[model samples]
Target chain A: MGPAVKLKDLYFKYSIHTDRSFILQNINIELNRGEYVVIAGRNGSGKSTLLKIIDLIYPPERGDIYIFGNLINEKNIYEARKRIGLVFQNPDTQLITGTVVDELAFGLENAGLSPNKIKSIIEETVEITGIKSLIDRRTDELSGGEKQLVALASVLAMKPDILLLDEPFSMINVIYKERILKIIENFVRGGKTVVLVSHNLETALNEALNNSLMADRCIIMQSGRVEFDGTPASLFERKAEYIESLGLRAPIAVRISSEINKNIDRNFPICSDIKSLVKQLTGLKGKELKK
Target chain B: MKELIKIKDLSYSYNSQNDSRSIYFRNKEKSSVLNNSFALKGINMHIDRGEIVGIIGPSGAGKSTLLQHLNGLIMPQQGSIYIDGKSVIDEWDQKELKKFVGLLFQNPEDQIFEKFVGDEIAFAPLNFGFSIDDVRKSFKDFLEYFGYEYSFKDRLTYKLSGGEKRIVAFMSIIIYDPRVLVLDEPTASLDSENREKLIKLLEDWVSSDRAVVLVSHDMDEILRLCNRVYILNGGRVVSEGPTENLLFDEALLEDNGLDVPEIVRLYLMLKTSGFEKIKKFKTETDFINWIRELKNHA
Candidate 1:
């Protein structure tokens, strides 16, 4: 198959006459199947807008979009949307059912699945998302993080070929955040595509740096433009200035390794985790002692 | 120091008769789930003036529920909450208590209602009987202090991005000049620069008579800004102490489904590696400075 998604010279604005500038400008990106890409940028940099456009919620003012090698127009928009699942930033915006179980089943029911199939899919989804306990509870009673998880589960139940998440970890605790990331990793391993927009640059960068399976590429948006599109390592190593200019700090391990390397005037590989970085530092200390 | 806010054996549950039309009563079979469980159970905590107190836990651990009681958004079904030694339930009216304790909800869209940013910021003060001229002046001063252009006040509230909406919600509350500020995940969608600005602003805002109660999942912010911390789980206080003491305890934080801040984790690892002279630094800059000093000594 062709790229999972392709956007060429895409431009978008909420209002053409009232707004002065496009929310997304001249964006060209091709995301491959089984690739996990993270889009990072400062707030109001149009990261979320780009996700919305790709999910087919917003039509671009000027651009061409192709999904699975099929051009997206009015007639085929619904077909394209069926293959993509978007979990919005605000859980309240996406959740419409009265209860969690109903919410998970809503998408499957709409997809015209049999009752048995829908039940099985929801059971499988709840197990994967670890939300089995929440299946009977009302959706409105869920905490922000719980609601966010349910939103993801609802999307996952649809079994979309491409998954787009907007700041999925923004409200979740660290433990659940790690769990959901693993879920996303497994999804991509199944030959699916995942595009996650994250405000937590450190976590996203670390994911890309440490595990290519979790995130293969990183794209930084600035003022509605794709300023940096490369591997996470390249973004941290060659485009540190760009990351700094975005008012985002690099990952802790990357930052600490760079500082240590600068002070000792020695080149050391960038480490993504604290444990690895510590090991590197201790080895360096031992070498210096022997000298 | 005087206690600005105190909670004694405070508890709450959503299983009330009046809420039958709400989510708590939507399903009779699942009524025993979260509704029957106390959102907060006998929670005892206090915040002193001039202190930034942090409340952290996993999702649905009653952090937000506890915060709602401070501003009278939710009434305690079991215990008492005192603001300035006045009872929130019995003594002070809800509106009066809200004036003293301003709350910024987890979602900025919850608190923001006005069309324009200026109107949203000025809403509370105008309703509290402040003069229009004074409100306008305070709005201008707020913009300038935050390093925003004066024209930013003209932007529509709904048109603003998620982070910008958060700033406006914060401004609306701060403009009223409350004695205590309650924030829920205040830095959720904010970029680093804006997050830094907020940290600095909070540092400057607290005084001998003012305090802040912060609820967040971001341990780094809690470590940097809070003087004391409370860890809640299952609607109860699992641990409470000075921020450094509780935050550095990886076991305690991990037990509550929280992550130790990366800098603190690094510090502890270094300490175990025999960097005994190193102190616990809250900010990354401090950690780097210590590394530089170590290099110079070598």
Candidate 2:
């Protein structure tokens, strides 16, 4: 099969009367089946705009987009969107139902599924997302993080072929963050595509490095253009200053290991977590003791 | 140190008649589940002048509820709050208390309602009866301070990005010069550069008589900006201490649904690996300096 998603020379601007320049310009990207890609950049860099274009919420000013070997146009826009599920950056913007149960059922109902089918889908979804406790709660009463989880659960219940998440972890706590990452891992394991946009590259990099299945590609955007596109490991291999210059922070392990490499003039493997960094440093200490 | 705000046995529940009725109509099974629980339970805390006090916990831990009480948006049902040594419930009206304690809500769109950026920044000051000329002058100065062009004020508020909207909301509150600034997840959607700019702005804004109350899920920000932190779990203070001591407790942080800041984890790991001389450092630069010392000794 062709790539899960392909964008060619895409350009987008909010309004011709108000916007003087294109908010997203000359974008070219191809995502494959089961690929997990992270889009990282500063605010106003068109990260969310890019996601919107893929989800068919925003019509591009120019260029072509292909999903599952099919061109995206008005004739097939709804069909394309059915395969794509987008969880917006602000949970409030996407949550429209009065209760969590209804929220989860809205998409399935819209897709014309039977009540029995919707119930089974919701049961599986709530179990996967671990939001069963919130099934009957009022949406407005949920805290920001709980609302975020509910939004994710609602999207996951649809079982889209391509999942696009925009800053889903911004408001959630650490525990929920782990659960969300695990959900993403499981989804990708099912041979589906996942694209996540995050401002915190450190967390994304940590997950990508620690778990082999988390992120396969990392794309860095700046000023409405892709600046770097490579594996997360390769992204970290660049100078720490270069990453910081792009408004991204290097993972703590990568930063510490790079500093030590520069000081000792040795090529030590970059690590993504504290445990691995400690092991490398302890090995170095043992070598010094022997010398 | 002078205490700018104090809460005594403050408690709040969301069991209002209207709320109960709505819950009953919406979902009968869930109404009983929520009607009996308190949003905030017997919380006592204080914020001193020239300090940034942090409140952190998992979702629904009453962080926002507590912040709302700080500015009298929500009156305590069972206890009392004092601002500048004056009882919030007895001595001050909501408007007066709001001017003294400005709150920036979690969602910037909630706090921002004006059309233009300039108008939004000026709304609070103008409402407080400040001269229009002074407000305009201060607005220009604020733009210049933040390195924004004067024309930036003309941009439509709705057109601004998430980070820009947050900055506008922050400016709206600080324009009126509130004694206490309460920020709910100020850095939630901000990028690295904007986050640094906000940290510097907060450092520059606080003075001997001014203070801030910050609620965030970012442990790094909590460690860097706050002097004291209170970990609220289930609407009560489960742990409270100076930032350095409190944040380093990995077990406490994890139990409260928080991640240990990367630097803290690194420091502990290094110490356990027998780097005894390395001390706890707040910033990455300090850690780098310690690493340099170790290299030179080697």
lDDT of 2 by residue, B1-298 (tens): 4899989999888653334232213444444436436889899999999999999998878898899899988888998888999898889977878898999999898888889999899999999888999898888877776657999898889888777788888888888889899999998888877788888989999999999999998888899999999999888989999999999999999899998888898888888888877788998778767656655656
Candidate 1 docking class: medium
TM-score of 2: 0.94
Q: Which lDDT tens digits does candidate 1 get at residues A198-253?
A: 86688666544444444688888899999889887677675334577876767888
Candidate 2 residue A133 C-alpha distance from true site, Å: 1.9
lDDT of all predictions: 0.85, 0.85
Stretches of candidate 2 off by over 4 Å are A16-19, A207-213, A258-272, A283-291, B16-32
lDDT of 1 at A128: 92
Q: Write model 1 residue lDDT over B1-298, tens digit each, in one string.
A: 3999989999888663323333322444544474546788999999998999999999889888899889999988899999999899889977889899999999888889989888889899999888999999989998987668998888888888878888899999999999999999999988877888888999999999999999988888999999999999989999999999999999999999997887888888987885677798988788777666655656
C-alpha root-mean-square deviation, candidate 1: 2.8
Model 2 error, position B284 (Å)? 1.3
For model 1, report DockQ.
0.52
